[model samples]
Structure formats: C-alpha cells, structure tokens
Target: MRERTMNLLKLNIVVLIEKYKKVTDVARELQLKQPTVTFHMKSLEEELGVPLFHSRKGRIVLTEAGRALYPYAQKMLSLHNEALRTMEEYKGMGRGTLRVGAEPAVQSLMMPVIADFLKRHPGIRIEVQVEPEQKLKALLMVEEIDAAIIEERAALELPLAFERWNEDEVVLICAADHPWVLLEELDPGQAGQERFVRHAPGSQLDRIGQAWADQHAINLWSPLTAASPEGVCRAVRAGAGVAFFSRKALAGNEANEGGGIRMLKVPGLEDPRLQLGAAYRKEGSPASLINEFVHFLRTCAQI
Candidate 1:
C-alpha cells in the first residue's frame, strides 16, 4: 500500500494544539468532533513517524519535533491566507506585518500617532521597538527592522533612504523656582556656575548641550547623567539642574504652559536642532507598506 499523505488540516490541528494545548479547544476551533480531530492527529503522527504532542493532565503539550514544525506550519498557513486575500482583493490590498524601530523620545511622543495609523489600517499589523539612534541605524542597515524614526542623522552615513518629517529645537529647561529660570537673559557662560543634569555622553542631546557650552567658554559641571529623556525631565523637575529638551517634548505640558519650568534661549550659542526622519533600506524594500506608513506619518505631522 502507498504511504498516507499529510494535509493542511493535520498541520492546522498541530498548530491549534500547540496554541491552546487542549483537544476540546482545538476541536471547537476546527469545528470538528473531538474523536475525529484525535484520529487525524494519530494519523499524522504515524505518517511522520514521530509523536507530535504529549498528553499531561488531560492537556496537550507539543513535543520537541512538534515545536520545530510549528513555525513552518504557521508560515505556510499565513502565506495561503495572504494569497487568498490578495486574489480576492484583486491585488489592491496592503496587508502584512510592519516592524519599526524608534528612539525613546520618538517612541513616547510619536506612538499615539502610530497607534492611530494601526487603527486606520486594521489589516496591517505593527510592532514597534525602542532603541537608541545608533542601534536603530544599525538595525536598519542590517535589514532587521522595516524602518526607523530617529533624531540626528549626522553620526552614521549608512546607505539608506530618509525623509525629513519635522525639526525641533533643543531648549534649556530648569525648575520654575531654580535661580537660572529667573535670569533676564540666559547665556551659555552660566553653565559652569550651575550644576547640570546631563544625558549620557553618547546621546545626541548630550553632545549638543556639551558643544554649546564649550563654544561659549563655559565649563559643564555634570554630576549626574541620565540615559532616558524621562529621567532627565524628572531630575530637572526635582531641581537637579538645567538640562536640554526638545521643544516638542515640553509643548502642551502644564509646566511649560503655566511656567512651572522655564525654557531659556542660550545667547551666542548655536541653537542645537534635530531633524526627525523616517528611514528605510534602499535595496529590495517593501515599497507599498513603506509608502503607506510614510504617508501616514506625514498626515500626522500635518495635524
């Protein structure tokens, strides 16, 4: 007799068992009788000559062999579904998963807009990862993420495409009660006399602040350094010292609006500015998804 054949149903049953780990649940999802599903499982195991799942406490657990096969099975099913949908929609639909990387400041500030895009395009799945500018750039170069939203593109000259979305100026922020806030005209020369709460040395924001101070012949007395925007904000709120923040970050805050913290312009210092951009790999790119996402960002920026 000829050997039996493996079918899509059998693969689906294995995937369902791995997901729910209960025969009853799998049977319900498949809309088949429990015994029939169990029979298919047995037949599949015999054909493959390996146990796909092990039973424990009346629940199903995938075996090592089953674990290895699960991902491939899932991908096959996904491709089948995608093909059907593509045909049904006459190849006009934009569907698939988009993985994006962003820096901390962008993640916190821009996530709402990104979430809105997801809501509008419910068919498209999105995953956002937070990383520093350098790491985000590295991931883009390696094709690890589809795209990235980053600040200060001057560090690495990677062979990638970028679109400028917005520009923000770095402002010096201090607690409302801090003596620096009361100054009539703030100059970078005052940096040495004040204890500064700076960002980590490697960050773009830190570099800008330090460069501004140095150019003005001021010594930066940084006793504390933070790796996160929120940390620097909190330290500034606690009267630690003045730190540089983006105007976009301070906008709409009660402190900024009601004068809880003061935003001072540094005289004779080059106003540090950052251009936020959306970047993607230039070769073999996912053109449709990238275009849609960039359009969505442009709409958001307009609003």
Candidate 2:
C-alpha cells in the first residue's frame, strides 16, 4: 500500500540510486527486491507530482526534482541518525539548562552556533551571559555559568581549565573618506592622536582598545562611546571617529558599517594569536550539560 506521506525509505532509495545508478544495486542495499524498489520510486514520484529519476539505457539517474530533494533528504536522515546518537550519548536532554558566558566578540561569532544547538535540542534552554573574561571567571567560581568563551586579550590564568577554540583579529575601522583609511603604512604611536569612537567603557573591547593605546603610548581620544558595537561602527561610518572591532563581528554586521566604513590595519594590532577559548570550573567534575555545551563550543566556534 502507498503511504500518504513522504517516506524516508523512498528518499533513501533516490539517494542510493544516485550512488549506485542501478535498480538492482539499490534494491540489494535496501533489502528490497528490484520490483518493490521500482514501485516505491513510482509512488514517491506520483506523490510529489514530479519524476525523481530517469533511466538512461540501463542506468538510473536522478532528475532535477531528485537533485533538489537530495540535500534535504540527506539532512533528514542525518538528523534521524543524530537523534539516535544523542539518545545513546546521554540518558536524556529533555529538560535542562546550559548557562553560557561569552565576551561580545565571541558572542558575535557564536550566536548562530548557539541558535542551531538550541533548535536541535528544543527541550534545553540556553542562558547566555555576555561579559568580560574576568567577570566570567568569577561566575565560574560561583558556578553561575556552565561554560565561558573568552577572548585571548581578556583571558587570564584562572584556576579553571581553558581550551582555545577559534582565533580572530581586531581590526580598526574608519569612515571611507577618512585620511587614514587608504594609508598603507599606519603608525601606532600616533593612533591616540586621532579622534575615536569606542564601545561602552569597561567592556572587553574597550579594554582592548585602551590597552593597545597604552602599549603604544598613544593618548587615544574618544568623543563618543557607544553601548553597542553597531553604535560604535555607526559613529565611525558617520566620520565621528574610528573604533576597534572583531573582524568576525564586522563581517556579520554589515548594517553597522554601511558603505562608508573601511577596515584599517594598524601596526600593533591584527594578530591571529588573539584567539578565543572556552573556560570552565576545575574544582569538581562538570555536569553532563556543561560537558555537552563545551563540546558544542569547541566544534562550532571555528569557521
């Protein structure tokens, strides 16, 4: 009997045919006779109102309809396998919370990863804390957060174990028409002499900028300090000043840059070793949720 809904078996058949390109081969792998496999293909085609495959001499090939369906089919099957794996990996993720601490730079890059994990594990709620590394370390001591993603600049030799995941650069941005925008050789010593717009004071980003200025002995001047990265970039784009931004954040948040912002490479900045890492408490064994979320960070924090 034909099922009213789409069957994974039929989808698998289409996928298998793409690989084997023969009815007998697909039937053998799927543990069905050739005729039964053919019937499934016909039924699947009828339900979709489009042919999934076409025969070329004695070979089978996926048609345009099947080509379009391939990735979705593979994704569905993969998720099914993932569900089984998750079930085996842990007793249950039905109800739990994963508290995550991240700096704004890490948060900008990891938001999608967080979203995707939450979408897959709908039963779990994620509470994200965007704070500096030191504060996050304090939270770890008190067990306020299960995982903390920290920037290298703000990272400290905390009692907790920290694992580096991804590295990104902090770039300087200015209005496209700014005199420094097209310069190939910029002097860090004089960076502080220029007008600047910075992120909110006390933030890791602000701290980075402040520290960089100190290192170069530049008396960095800021006429405006914005509460959000977007605000800082917006001011820079309006020719108010330049600001330091994570390259990853700049890429994902084009709206903040507009067409008037240009990224500048200052001598003292733009190092790749400024990677981000995950930190957690080390005094006691971590809970399963902590371990799971850390694993997620390790895997998805990189491009």
Candidate 3:
C-alpha cells in the first residue's frame, strides 16, 4: 500500500482554496506566500497521484478529485485544530478533562475534588470511576485513566509515580442493637469471639482490621464478608456484625439512623495503616488538568 504524505499544511491549503477560490486570497488568509501555497497544493496532488484543482477564470477551483477529497481534507484540518486547542487551552489557564479512578474506601475523598475542580475551572470535567485497588492499578498501568486515588500499601508493581493524599485511619462501627454500641470505648481484648462484618479480603480495610485485631490479641470472627461499603453497612445495620472503614468513607453519610449503627473508638487499635494517595504512570506526561487536580488534592486539606 502507498504511504500517505498528506499533512496539516496541505489540508489547510485545500480547505482554503475551496473557500477562497483564488491562490492569492487563499495565501492571504493562511498568511502563506502564494508560491508556497501553490507548491503545497501541487505536492499534495502529486503525493496522491491525482489532479486536485485547476484554474478557472483566473481563480483556482477544485477539480472532481479535489471535490471528492474536500470533506476528508476539511475533517483533517478540523481535527488538527481541535488537537492544538485541546493541548493549549489548559496551558492558557482553561480546564481540560480529567479521567480518574479510585477505590470505594476513598471515594468520598476522591469525589469532592470533582466539584471543587469544576467550580474553579468551569471548562474542566472530572470523571471518577470507583473500582478495587487491583483493577485501578491495572488501569493506571495502561493509562486508561490519567490518575488514581487509592489505598497505598506495598509499593505498587506497576510503573507509576505518586504523592500521599491521606493517611486513612480506620473507624470501627456496629449496629445500634449490637452490645458494643452504647460503650464509648471498645477494648479489642474484650472483642473475644464477637462477630464482625468485614469488607472482602485483600481490601485495605480488611488488612487494617486484621492487623488491629492481631495487635490487640483479639480473636474476631467474621460471620459475614462484604464486597462493598454498602454491603458492610447493611450487614452491620442489620445486627449481623460490626465493621471498619476510613472516616472519610462514612463522613456525613447516614450510616446509622434511629440507632442503626454506632462508631466505636477501639482502644489500642493500631494507627491508621491505609495510606491513600494520587498515582499516575511514571512514563506518562500528565496534562495540566491532571497536575492541577493533583495539586487540589494536596492542598484541599480535608477529605
């Protein structure tokens, strides 16, 4: 197959000639020399091995082949202009689209930036997709999203760079009807054999909970396991068991109503182990939107 040699300049010349119908006018509009414009047009016709335009009444006019190529040429020019504008707008202080991913445990923390960013940069759009950490890591590796706010643990195996977004301290909660609800302090040592509803294994919350339990020599039982915060909330509220989550995950949320659930300050609980942060591919060049949003995450100072 013949390699295509068409470029933005040639496409622009064709589009201009179609609109202006004269080499002199086309050159003036493009701010190009008439000879330069003529040369590009001739080269494009040669590259495609087709006659594109001919002189009619001393004005250049599209021939049948040129007419056939008009729509494609126009489209190419439009895309080229759009590409430039998309890249340059943010540098000029305009907002651009930011695609981000996060795990549900940090969804609350991740979502507020969406509103804040759009309010400050009205031209920007932020799309946040919530998924498990493993899936998020996969997406980050492939750059399916620009960045991620996720639970930080052992160094991610993926090629990426990141900054700490938050140190997520786990909060223990139980249904109001649970015996532990009215207590102001939960002694993990006393948790002996008490059941707990937990987020699925491998989740940061689960790991933190396990460590806390181990540190206190507590033998906790998981009568029920959940895959989402909602599931854990539902189970605990139903009196099935207690669970734990980062404070941001439940802040302002009606996790307990009518004494549905109560957060407990577990004594001697290990300090917050889940580190939340923003990460992007090490090799990827982040757009202004990504950089600005990451900055917002760092300075917002609250989840």
lDDT of 2: 0.77
Which residue runs of candidate 1 sit more than 4 Å off their true CA positions? 1-93, 152-156, 217-219, 252-259
| Candidate 3 per-residue lDDT over residues 234-271, each given as its tens digit | 78888887788776576645554465767766567645
Per-residue accuracy of model 2 over 117-162 as CA lDDT, tens digit each: 8886787888999875567877888888877888654556666777
Please give the CA lDDT of all the candidate structures. 0.76, 0.77, 0.76
Clashes of 2: 0
lDDT of 1 by residue, 194-245 (tens): 8888876656677677777777777788899877777777788888888877
Query: Each model's TM-score?
Result: 0.65, 0.64, 0.76
Which regions of candidate 3 deviate over 4 angstroms? 1-6, 14-38, 44-76, 90-96, 152-160, 166-168, 181-186, 216-219, 273-275
Quality of model 1 by C-alpha lDDT:
0.76
Worst 10 residues of 3 by lDDT: 250-259
User: Candidate 1 — which pairs collide?
Assistant: none
Which of candidates 1 and 2 is the stronger one according to lDDT? 2
RMSD of 2: 15.9
